[model samples]
Target chain A: MEMKFPMKKFIFYKRRTANFVMLSLSLLAALITIVPLVFIFYYTISKGISNLNIDFFTKLPTPVGETGGGMVNAIVGTIILIAIGGGIGIPVGIMSGTYLSEFGKNKFGILVRFFTDVLSGIPSIVVGVVAYTLVVIPMKHFSALAGGIALAILMIPTITRTTEEMIKLVPQSYREAGLALGIPKWKITVMIVLKTAWKGIATGILLGLSRAAGETAPLLFTSLGNRFWSTDIFQPIASLTVYIYQYSTAPFKDWNDQAWTAALALILLISVLSLVFRIITRSKYKA
Target chain B: MVVNEQVNITTEKTKSPHIAGSSLKISVKELSVFFGKTKVLSDININIFERKVLAIIGPSGCGKSTFLRSLNRMNEEVGGNFTGKIIFDDEDIMKLDPVYLRRRIGMVFQKPNPFPTMSIANNVVAGLRMNGFRDKKKLKEIVETSLRQAALWDEVKDILHESGANISGGQQQRLCIARTIAMQPEVILMDEPASALDPISTAKIEELIFELKKKYTIIIVTHNMQQASRVSDYTAFFYMGKLIEMDKTIKIFTDPELKQTEDYISGRFG
Candidate 1:
């Protein structure tokens, strides 16, 4: 009973060693994941930086094997496709997500969530085929509208699920505060619940958009690729992803170089989007 | 006004041992609450009087919050069902639309829950706008008055444009109070409003409660016996889903009728 234990010695050393090992392991894992990202930036930047210039952004693609060309039309088409896709997807996703979180708390909501998950898991190429049959066949041509539809379908579930999760993250107390003021349930959802989660919802939209921006398989059959500067959404349109796919696969050396530059442009667009959403999420608490 | 008519009608017929002939604002009759299957409050009856501070005091899990929330049907939000009759003023509140009824009997929760997405001015004016009051001059007057009444206007008058969350904990609670008062409810239900605050803030809230009693009948559920005694005119003690005793705050602390009340007031068991 009088024997004194080793004063904070035995457990302290053990805990310190264990903490060190775990910390090192975590650091290793982080580096391992970051290494691949660094490698991607390395290759894309090294290969693409030299090809980027004014003509690369402004001029139309020269015929097949030409030395100098740009994807100006493809860039414009991608922006239009994203606009149409996001316009169609974001509002519907937010509303459906609101219903799921706020009012649609029954068996039907569970089924809706399950179906949405399954839809997201479906292959993008398969979705492209489905769009080919649904829109391309009826219209008798592959148009930018069809491509936009395919991208919108991909975005809806991703946005919907994220919106629902973000809305759920809002404290129930906020809703109660709104209801205590005799605000209608729908009004409460829109004014209080949705406003509180708006940043998170916007992040979800950006993610969906970024995913849509990089997609190639879905647009291959839907938009079917274009070579000219076309403003008509009903007509076939070119996108950065489609141009990359076409040029990278072609035997022409110059076309492959243009494809690398197009890839860089897309990467920059997505990173900028990701950065904006990140800042929005960060500053939301300040608001 | 209907409460005045009821006071006249029941002035002679009622036989009450404590607080006799108090003009009743709300009458609870055969009230019982159940969360799905488990019963919480059982056949509780009390007369909440005109512009009075009624403190519902009990230990944790004693159905105190349940009983308080039941008054304004706020319990429904948490899936609590009650089988009873609560006559608010002269009307049975059970039949009234909950949204309309809540505007008349507003609630402040345990935590200070000001709308975080709004400015301080907007938070105070939220209920007024929800009720379709758009006159900016009148809205500004209500905002100033309510904040002043809650004792927060002096500190925050310059920063009305700031977000509700950009304030101290005590100030946030006061802002929530201002928000509720802007609604101009006849009855304000507070579930441990001062429980989350420090001593100084608690004292401030108690003083606000005393001042608020001039216009509103306040029902505050507090676990602190000292707080109950300090702020409330009438105190109702609850124990194990039953009304143990209810009397003037002085009598409840000094000499309660029930043994459990004495045990709790003496800090025997929470």
Candidate 2:
């Protein structure tokens, strides 16, 4: 097992060289991943910041060939759509996730989990079609409700799975402690298990919100993109993503400029959502 | 022979001041436990005296924890199947509601598990609060009393609103004990409660156990032999899921009737 001193030094150099090479390769890979994100942010901000002004946020889109207007209606419509989606998705996701983690250890649980994975993989366009048939067709028009429903369907799987994982991350000892106190199973799941994992679950919700906010395909057919201010759930509603899609494709230069601004605003909206949730759920004590 | 020894101990225990008028709080008859197809405990029979601390000591995998958990039906939470009767106040405990039974027979685990999301005061009263008890003044009183009983109040009184997990390990364990005490259970089960604690904390817990048994019957499972001797009035030695011996603590430590018990306690072998 003994090696000569010269051989040992040679081996050490070779090992050190391998370590250096691997570290450089990993650093290269990390840079490769970050480069595209940096480019996208840089391009979006530079092209969008010039068009962004107080009017861009306060006024409705101008008539065709007219110059000065904002996407205020689209912005408001997007918020309403997100509110509806969250109203439907958050409770369903949390309850189902709680069910899966706490009581779903059997065949039914496995089946439900499998279906959730499948649902997450289904194309957003296909969900749009499903919402089209279920809501738009039934109501006889493309509406904000249909778009919200489509987003809710898209959000459910992310929220459900993340919630289950987060709840599972809570130590088994916490459940045992609750049970030993003679608290009911439902109470323990709600008050102790859910409370402990809320920070993680909030992040999951934020992920779902960001994904839904960025969706263009689903809202394209479901909301159908209105030109005027409209807040009614039954009427067509404009959203930032849909406006970005419509304006970016039009031949007009100003519409294309506004599209970039809409993209920036969409990103800002998600960032604000994340910040608000962080502030709301911030831990009061050092952990 | 072991059954005859148990009878002698019962008769002898009746003479001690601590056991002079204390009645049988729980009786296990031919108890056995299984997790799926694997048996973990078999054909166990024991009588627990009221207001006395009975310690179960053995090597790892001897099913002492399973036995302690079975007392409160917490074993069923981990999917354990059981056979035979456990009588509490002349009723088969298996037929009783597991929730109600657990309320009557609370447990403290080997690791301190104060609810991390709760404040120190809130953790003490979590059981009551969760069960629909909403009286604020009563809850405050219960929190103070339970904290005092668990011997953690003075150290944590000023920081009652801090997170339960924001304390030292021993304090957290004592906080868990206070949480259990808030329920005012008839029995408290401790599963290697102080094995995770330092010596000073271990002494504090042992002293708490001594004070607690004046009101609640206790069953503790421990790997530490000296801890069993120091805290328990009666000690039962288990080897390979079987109770090798049960007797007064002094006898178990000084003059155990079985060779296995003597060997295990003297550190000859587990």
- Largest DockQ belongs to which candidate? 2
Ten-residue stretch with the least lDDT total in model 2 chain A: A1-10
Every candidate's TM-score, chain A alone: 0.92, 0.96
| Per-residue alpha-carbon lDDT of candidate 1 for residues A116-143, written as tens digits (9 for 90 to 100) | 9999999999999999999999999989
Q: What is candidate 2's lDDT per residue for A102-205, written digit by digit as tens?
A: 99999999999999999999999999999999999989999999999999999999999999999999999999999999999989989989999998998899
The weakest ten consecutive residues by lDDT in model 2 chain B span B11-20
What are the iRMS values of all candidates? Answer: 2.1, 1.5
Q: Which stretches of candidate 2 lie over 4 Å from their true place?
A: A1-8, A285-287, B1-19
Q: Candidate 1 has what TM-score?
A: 0.93
- DockQ, each predicted model: 0.57, 0.69
Residue runs of model 1 more than 4 Å from their true location after superposition? A1-3, A7-25, A274-287, B1-22
True interface contacts retained by model 1: 0.59
Taking the tens digit of each residue's C-alpha lDDT, what string does model 2 give over B52-169?
9999999999999999989889889999989988888777988889889989999999999988888999999999999999999999999999999999989999999989989999
lDDT of 1 by residue, B1-270 (tens): 445565445434322124554568888877899999999999887778988889999888999988888877888988899887999978999889999998999889899998888889989999888667899999999999999999999999999988899999999999999999999899999999988999999999999999999999999999888889998888888889988788788888898887888999999888
